[model samples]
Target: MQLSVTLIIIIVTTLVSISGFSSQKIIDDLIFYPPAVTQQRQWWRFFTCGLIHADFGHLILNMYALYIFGVEVERAFVSIFGKYGNLVYLLMYVSALIVCLLPTYRKHKNNYYYRSLGASGAVSAVVFCFILLFPLRKLGLVFFPVMIPGFIFGTLYLIVSTILERRSSDRINHSAHIWGAIYGIVFLIVAANFFSTYPVLQSFVEDVKGWLASF
Candidate 1:
């Protein structure tokens, strides 16, 4: 099999997450702990936290989402940005790890108890980027019976994520999902302006409008 960057990311993330399951040290060192970043200046945690996950289910869900969305987004980036596509793709993933958690870090930097791990934020970034490029594409949850157009899914996702972030006390970082998705769309627009002649934003709007008109 030709090893694309998306495949390599999935493989590396899976291996690291599995290794972390056997070694608490791996989890402790890599998991996002705001206190560590604030007190000890372990800024690398912003990036490394994405390399480990909390459990098998967390790892699988994240990597599975990444695998599905990342390949298409990567391919689109390559077609748009040409030789620099891979670099831009890597930047989107890594930056999403840090940018998506900025709010959490600010709020909990002194809360020694706050901790999180997983690549869900980065995966969200990839998924949103794909949606931006293909707004009319159908997307559905694995267990959900209904499939919806990508733009509608994106809107619903943002609403649900915002609600979950505010009202839910679950350990999941819904904030990251919200911010990561926004970052993905904004990053694509910015990069597209600089790197390619493709009317990224216009195309997205036209695609969504065309889809709406069809209905």
Candidate 2:
């Protein structure tokens, strides 16, 4: 199922790119960016923005992460939710976008020219979900080139994104990533509470507690 979904994402992205539909342009034209406001507002842009990527490199990177982490998260979700797994995935993706847009909207409501593109928020959702589902797994950092356990990595990621949100002016949506991670963590906890069969998430919470205690 994971492989199938990954292939579908790649195919859809590639087809969209080949059709001359730039993801960045889509984001610029639609999504809830402050700068995108015009006399004629297109509300559908909010959902379409995530499907668009700035370039091939951007698309490839995001798709790769989606394929890598998304599959595992999907499997775990299916194991727990059974028939409701797809619904959870859909909700997580949409929730990430909503959370991502709010902070930008709050900060730039008056500017009406703020723009952002890419699927970083949704990608963060998958990455963080993976971390929660597999807290003991080691994650390799691209910058540091080292592997760290999932819980530590997830915590560090949240912290780094939060810190960068305050200090950086880079194009990357660090705030969206941080917020998406928070959403992922919260979603998992809430879902676990409601669905006791999701041992993976339950164990993850326990592992996180144990990791915290070790400090």
Candidate 3:
């Protein structure tokens, strides 16, 4: 069996996150600390922050989600973009890490107490990309007992993320979730239009219609 890029990412992230559990320095240096980025110019945190997670639960949830969706998204990209697919996949993930946090950075760039660490942003990007290709697929959250269509799930997710982002009542980076998903859909549309002959939007409509007709 061949090792996939998705598996490779999961292994590396799990190792780094576990190591960070013992080494506070690792977390501090790698965590997305806006003040550090703004004052000391430590820009790497934008990407490195995704390597460490807050706890075992956080790590597991993000990694599991990433693995489930990322593998399919990677495969789909290869089919769509051919030789440049891997590069595009990498670009989307890496860019999502930074782009998803831009809102947080702007709002808290001077706040010394603000810090976030995890792969949730990048994972959201992968999941949404998968959703775009498989809009009619069934999906269900662990806590949410009912299975729903992928596109419907994505829509509800964005709405919830937006609400949580505005509330700002918890430590979770809801903004990252919202923006990462947007980036994923936008990336797919732009990439397909410019680099491939795939009828992404048309296909999406047909898939939705097919799903609707089934009911």
Best by TM-score: 1
The models' CA-based lDDT, in order, is 0.91, 0.72, 0.92
lDDT of 3 by residue, 1-215 (tens): 97777888899999999999999999988999999999999999999999999999999999999989999999999899998887889899989989999988999999998899999998999999988999988999888879998999999999999999889999899999998899888889899999999978788889999888988
Cα TM-score per model: 0.97, 0.83, 0.96
Candidate 1 Cα errors over 4 Å, as ranges: none
By TM-score, the candidates rank as 1, 3, 2
Q: Give the winner by lDDT: 1 or 2.
A: 1
Candidate 2 structure quality by residue, lDDT tens digits, 172-193: 7787788777787778678767
Q: Model 1, 39-111: lDDT tens per residue? A: 8999999888999998899988999899889999999999999998888998899899999999889989999
Clashing pairs in 3: none
- Assess candidate 3 and give its lDDT: 0.92
Query: Of the candidates numbered 1 and 2, which has the greater TM-score value?
Result: 1
- lDDT score, candidate 1, position 182: 94
